[model samples]
Target chain A: MEKIKVKNVFKIFGPNPQKIIPLIEKGKSKEEILKETGHGVGVNNANFAVEQGEIFVVMGLSGSGKSTLIRCLNRLIEPTAGEILIDGENIVGCDKDTLLQIRRKKMAMVFQNFALFPHYTVGENVAYGLEVQGEDLETRHKKAYEALELVGLKGYEESYPDQLSGGMQQRVGLARALATDPDILLMDEAFSALDPLIRKEMQDELLVLQARMQKTIIFITHDLDEALKLGDRIAIMKDGVIVQIGTPEEILTHPADDYVRDFVQDVNRVKVLTASAIMKKPDAVVSRKDGNKVAIRKMQEAGISSIFVTDKERHIRGIITIDDAMALLKKGEHSFESIINTEVPTTSPDTSIVDLLPIAVDTKYPIVVVDDDKKMLGIIVRVSVLSGILGEEE
Target chain B: MDKLQIGIYFEALIEWLTNNLEPVFEGLRTGILALIEGFEAFLLFIPSYVLIAILVVLAWKIAGKSIAIFTAVGLLLIDLMWLWPQTMQTLSLVLTSTVIALLMGIPLGIWMSQHDVVDNVTRPILDFMQTMPAFVYLIPAVIFFDLGEVPGAVATVIFAMPPVVRLTNLGIRQVPEDVIEAARSYGATRKQMLIRVQLPLAMSTILAGVNQTIMLALSMVVISAMIGAGGLGEEVLRGVTQMEIGKGFEGGIAVVILAMVLDRITQSLGNTGKTK
Candidate 1:
């Protein structure tokens, strides 16, 4: 299901938005539009859809209209013209009361600067949304504590915002947003204000929380690396227009234009290319019940030193070397499980190449890729990992 | 354009207001007189020693032990100079005018902060109110309310009201944009935004405005006394008229003591608001 659908939204900031919007539509540049009509285009005909539980990232440099676009989704910044559909309801034309209801019930936003009220205690700040919704104090307090616990701020409820560190204050902001339990999360540069180390920690925390919560998140960022790391799909914006949108791998492998290509050229692909992207289908896979002769013959035919052994259900049993398989055949072993080496290094499909570097370097055989259930997926050879880090061949 | 003669139009406008708004002026005069007289009577009802003790304790609670001691000595000195009653009267006037200024100014300031049109309209009017000689307001006040403590308070209120309004508007407007956005994004109503975010954040600035209003009111005391608003200002006026240096010194010292006490108390209040 599409949780959010933004269609042809335009936000022009000036005295006469309607008059200036035609200029925007006529392929006028932002500077030209401003010069001609004394109006600034905030978001020019932006259109996108966020699938349920997906992290859709909008990334651009400052004044690229990324922030304005996110704000428009929730109508925090009113759009000059467009339709924003949440659950098939057009919020663009929603009345003020209905918009307030949507903000309270459907969406919550996290800000970059940790906009926790300075005078409010952490608990009160967390409870603010519920308070505005007219919830009972006791219920809101309990929910606030649970939200705080989710953000790893368990007992700092009584403390003022100024008492906490910057990271902790941002945690409070996140907690406040989460306390409402809204289905859609709008995060506008939520971690850009943190120190680098803290920023990484917060990004990881957000990913962890997302895995558990499964909230549809529309994340805004100026950092390309963050978008690649966090986004299921990324939209690249320039001069108030969305230039390109694709998966991180697609964006990295096939940029739409010189602008996007230049953006990806400087990105560190090692951290972004996952094991799944580079991993090749295993050539020879023998069942544990298969005769040892079959394992050796399969390895020989495939020109490989080793063959992975799996059960009937494709659950990884272990790997067997050609020499071991040959020796087992000579010994007339009925089951290859005896000689199977379960000590072979394995990684998940989602593990990045940067994380697999040491494991890949130390392993003689290709690294086995497995799912959470230990089902064999594919194998990662050193050459494939290297090529994945470098871009795809033309 | 040989001297626009704008004052002639102002005079005509005032005349029209006076004629047409006589009932409104009467109602305002009655309310203000009642409040001032009530406050003065309450202060007089308390024994001087008890009142001093209460003030000392209040100062101690609000500021510190040092300010409390300072207040005690200042009040004692005023009493010893035989100006205690006059000092009480001035306190009443200052308190009355300050209360009225705050009541009117804060909401006006908040309204200005909320609307650009109101801010634009009032900004110049505030400038004129601030810079116009304090004596100029006294003439209209006297004409409207007749020469009394009420007229004095009316004049003082006009003089002192500007800072409160200006500072409140500034404070509310200067509240961090991100903070206001946060409030709005959370579905806070306009009232919720004002009470929960804007006012609390702007509190220190508003308190500073209040402090200025009180100080300005105190400065108007001697000037008000010339219009028959009896207090230490009366003694100062008498001394100036009869050339009694000794009497003038006593009244002047009492006024100085009262000003210090009020200024310290209010300034400390602003500091407290800031820290909180």
Candidate 2:
């Protein structure tokens, strides 16, 4: 189930995006609209939905409206034109009271810099969101301590923000956000301020937290690797619009446009794609049925290209010599898990034909395609991966 | 104590000794008297009382060149007025009160910070202490200690202690949250944190409070002298009573000089923490 949805989010940073809407509709450039009206667009027609208990990342360079988009989801910053649907209800016109209720109870945000109040102890900072929402001292303390315990800061309850290191302070920030037990976690580059080592640790900690808590998270970042490592589905954004929204594997192997392709070009799809694409057919079709050379000749001759251990018959079985399969076995195994060693060559159906061709060209194996049931559907030759790159659709 | 000025309090200790308590009280009494006598000796040891420039230069070095020049000119004018000796008496009394105020104020401030009860209980008292008229303190000092440098100095100390206490407390409290948390995470106890992190960070503000205390003490010269303080205050008193215009002018000028010099020196000391 989708937990939250952002539809046609346009947060313009001036008097009116309404006036500019007609120009945009007419396919006029943003430069032309701004030249006429003198207003800038922050986020332009962004649309995406996040599933419950998923880490849906929004990635862009700074000023690409990634932060603004995330902020709009929680209404921390208002969107000029959008409908935010949390659990299938529109929150576009939510009143102050309703917005406060949603913010306090459903979502909590963690900032880039650890926004722990300087005067507060770690425990107090963690408990503050609860306190702001009107929880009493004992209840809030218990909840805050529980959240701290979850983050492995159990004994640090009495320590002030200054007493902690940058990492520890961010942990307090995370714990504070968690204390409210919000249904959605909106983290705005929360660990970017930390050193590289600390950022890695916090990232891993967030993964573990997500695994345990299973809350819907909208993680925003400029780091592509962080997005890949954390996001269940990434929405790669550029110039305020989403270029694509897909799983990390999908983004890497099947990018939607030149922008997304360039963005994921550095990714190693050989490692990311599974083993269903490069497998051979299970029912080997032998052309000649008698002599030893005839069997090898038949295996070579058949365009179905089967090294058959069996036949298409009622419990039909055939004998296989070691030499008959050895030449073909060196090519690759076509399996779903890709749990085999890197020494093996295999590809998944999800692997882009363009990305899979080089390995195929070297090894001379068929590009295997499998169904959801792990049944081998067919095999694509090395030329198909190359052909797809050339815009020849089959 | 060296017993150079240890009075009968030292001798009668053994006679009244019911326990170790007698010696403790006697020891404290002797220590205090020794400090006073040491100060007295210090004031008199100067040859020609020409150490004033050292203070003047120090004030400039610490506070700035302006304070230094002001101090030098003020002292020169007082000497020209022929009130140098009387100025020394007034300086001694003001210094005595300031030392006592610091000795008492800082610990009370620290104590107040440590205990919520003490801070809450004493807040109103300190408010009253600061807001009340200066003469209200003098009446009690005169009634209990008799009119002299002792009562006058004691009264000045009481009158000036509140600001030192308040500033010290505020400064320590205002030390950044991160600094305190850093200390705590390092396993610093409450006392250790207070002494190490809080006190050092709060030093500038505390010194500012001390500077204010010193200035307040200096301003009390005529007030203290009116209650029998033996310094430039007495010179001014003489000027007023005898209707001697020459004496009054000399006394008033001497006072302005003393105030400027002390103000500059303490202010310099307070500001030294800044450039560093």
Candidate 3:
């Protein structure tokens, strides 16, 4: 079951929001509605489901109501219309007490501004959520320390928010959210305020945390790169409406609209496209079952000078060049090990094409793509690397 | 202009309240009288030397060495002038008025910060409270409680309460928007949000308002004396009416000394939670 499902939620901001819903339903543009009734559309007919343990990112520029949409999930800003179900409980129609309970027990949020209470010490700030839930001082402190240590800030317990650098303050914000041991996290542009290098470090740390925690997260951001890097799936929003929802590769390769296409166009595909994304099925690979004779014949048939050699289990053993195979045959060497070149470059399937460039450039053989156990997955040639950089058509 | 009769209607309103609300006025009068007496007794019970020493140490800790020395010297000068008792009385009155003002003002300010309608309704009233001549409050105060310290305190509270309310409201409202949103997102109930987030954050501003209230309360000391409230104001009034220039100047100096000490101490308190 989905952890959170938002179905046709609408958020209109102004006096008499309910009165303006009919106009939105009639398909009026945001500006037209504003001109007609002076109600600004915050989120227009948003619909999406977040699976448990998934990092579902909602991405848009400022004024796109991505913030509004995330707030709606927790009902920080009440939805003008529609149902939001969290673990099968509809948050939109929940009572105030239940909503508060849900927020206290089920979800926590991290803010873009690192909104640590200025007056609170780092320890106090981190423990604030637990404190709000009426936990005792001992449990709150213990949990707060644990959360701070998780974010690499265990020693900053007594420091004030103003005393810490921006990155450290942001960690305190993250720690505060994590102290409650919530099931879901709503991060609204949570890293947008940091310096670029620190932001990257924080992103990596979050990934590490997510690997351990496996908490479902709804991350909001305007930066496509951040969305692509962190999101399991991304929802692109424009003018308070979701334009498209897809994986990073799908968004890059098959954008649902011109806006999304234009958005993905400037992205550095080399950094985002992985080896598995562009690697091709090896046509002339030889296994131990196939002797040296068959290996040379397969290479010739495929019009290749070299072929990868694998064991019966399809784990990569080595590669053999056409010249080496012929030389071995002439020497009466029946052993495939004698003909195999063990100097073949290999990379994990998850390695980005950018990382593969140096290996692809230096190696004479196509770089072999392998899984964790050295199982041969495919081959990434120089042309495929170039094509991946250009955003693979296949 | 001849037919407005604003004065006549105001007179009728006061008369009606004075007659119909006798028990209410009596209750307020007794309550205020008890509070004033409690503070007065507390202040007077402390030996002049002991009080001065405590204030000096407080100043040193809060404001710095210079303010501490000034406190010691200035307070000693009040004692030297034989104005210690009068100074204590004025201090007690200012303390009582400030305590009462803050008691009502802080919650009102919190309430005002929460709702736009309350903010709007209270804004003009606060403006009127702040801008109306300090002497004007004395009339209602006198009518309600008769001539004594209670009326003087009532007038002083009215005169000094606005700054606390206004600044408290401003302080809470000035708390960062993202911070408030962060509190809300964490499932802070309305009360929790106010206590844990808003109040602590606004404390500095509210302390500043308290400082303003104390200053305004001290400013009203001599005016309150006109309605028979005793203290340094009585001495100043006596000196002035009897043409004793030196005595009046001495009383004025004592009031200034007391004001400076209170101001410096409270000002430092306001600067505590902030970097400043």
Candidate 4:
């Protein structure tokens, strides 16, 4: 089921919002409508549905209404018209009590400026959402502590927001949102305020958290690279309208318009694309139990000079070239251990292609992609990594 | 051209209020009189030296050592000038006015911050309260409370209340938009948002308003003494009418000392909240 679906959502700022919404519906441009009525159109007919456990990013430059659109999802900026459905329930026409309940029980948000309450300590800030929901003090504290640990801020609970660095403060912001255990997280340019290195760190941390939690998230960002990196599916907005919505690869490969094309054109794909996106299936592999003759037969059948060696569980041990297999056969060796090269280049599937480049340069063997258990998932050869950087599909 | 009968209309309005709201005025008079008496009695109950010691210690703790030393030396000079009782009275009056002003003004300020209509409606009224001569309200105050500390307090509260309201409203309004949005998105109820987020964040600014309110209240001491409200103001008034320059200077010096001590203490409080 779609976790949150926004349909025909319009947010007009200033007096007479209802009147201005009609003008928006009539296809009047934001600038023209603002000039005519002195009313700013914040979000014009924003329509999208975010699936459960998906990171649905809204990407646009400043004033493109991405922030406004995210705010409308939680009703921080009230939508002037149309329906917002959360888990198939229409939230647009819900009364104040119902809306408050929805916000309390269903959604929590993180902000761009790391809006950790300056007056509050990190733990207190994290506990704020639960406190507002009237949770008991003990539970609030426990949950807040757990959330701090989740965001890698276990010891900084008593520290004030301003005392921490900007990145640490944003971790507190993320922790606060996570403390609520809400079904959806609305991140409105949550990392845009951090320095570039910290921003990248935070993005990686968020992806790791999402992998574990599987919370539906609607992230907003102005940086195209950030969107491409974080978004499972990105909605590119322009002038309060969503110009395009697609996966990162799809957006990179086929931008819908000149605006989106311009955005993707400048993005450094080597840094944005990961190994997993371009990794090829292993043609042949010999288990630890396999004999030297079997390894040679498999490599010959696949027409490859080398093949990966794995245990019965598919945990990668090393690589064995045709010459090593031939040596093993000539020496009457039965075990593959003596000939297996344990110094094969390896990378996690999620490592960016840019990070893989140096390793890719020195290694003649394909880089082995593995999971946390060191179980081989796939292989990224030099050509695949190179083609991946060129925005080509293997 | 005939001049507008502003005075006549004002008199008639006061008369109408006095006639219709006599019981209400009487209750308020008793209430305000009790409040002032309570603070006055509390101040008087402590011996002069002990009270000074407490204040100096408070100054030391809150405002730092320099202000504390200044408070000790300055307060000793007031006692040396034999204005201890009168100084205490003025302090009590300032305290009473400040507390009352904050009580009424903060909620009104919060209301103004929440609603644009209330802000618009109260803004002009606040400006009038702030800018109009203090003497203008003193007459109605005296008529309503019948000439005593009550009337003085009423006038002082009216004169001093605007800054608290204005600053409270400004402080809450100035709370970063993103912070308020964060609170809302986290599902804080209106009251929770005010108490947990808005009020706590705006505290330093509101305390600044309180500082301004206290200063205004202290300024009204001499003016309030024109009525039967006795304080350092009475000494200054005596010095003025009887041509006792030394007494007036002594009274003025006491007031200045009191003002400095209070200012430093409150200013420090606001400053502490501002830092992380």
Clashing pairs in 4: none
DockQ (CA atoms), all models = 0.54, 0.02, 0.45, 0.54
Candidate 1 lDDT (Cα, whole model)? 0.90
Model 4 gets an lDDT of 0.90
Label model 1 with its docking quality class: medium
A72, model 3: CA deviation in Å?
A: 0.5
Question: Which stretches in model 1 have alpha-carbon errors above 4 Å?
Answer: A268-394, B1-20
lDDT of each: 0.90, 0.72, 0.90, 0.90
Q: Candidates' TM-scores?
A: 0.81, 0.45, 0.81, 0.80
Chain B structural similarity (TM-score) per candidate: 0.95, 0.82, 0.97, 0.97
lDDT of 4 by residue, A1-394 (tens): 7888888888889889999876776788989988999999888888889999999999998999998888888888778998999999998878999999999889999888887788888899999999999999999999999999999999998898888999999899999999989989989899989855578779889999999999999999998778878999999999989999999989989999999998887665467678766677789999988888999999999999999998888899999999978988898987777888999999987899989989999999999999899988788889888888787756
lDDT of 1 by residue, A117-171 (tens): 9989999999999998999999999999999999999999999999999999999
Candidate 2 Cα errors over 4 Å, as ranges: A29-37, A269-394, B1-276
C-alpha lDDT (0 to 100) for residue A326 of candidate 3: 93
Task: Give interface RMSD, every candidate, in order.
Answer: 0.8, 13.4, 1.6, 1.1
Worst 10 residues of 3 chain B by lDDT: B1-10
| Ranking of all candidate structures by their DockQ, best first | 4, 1, 3, 2
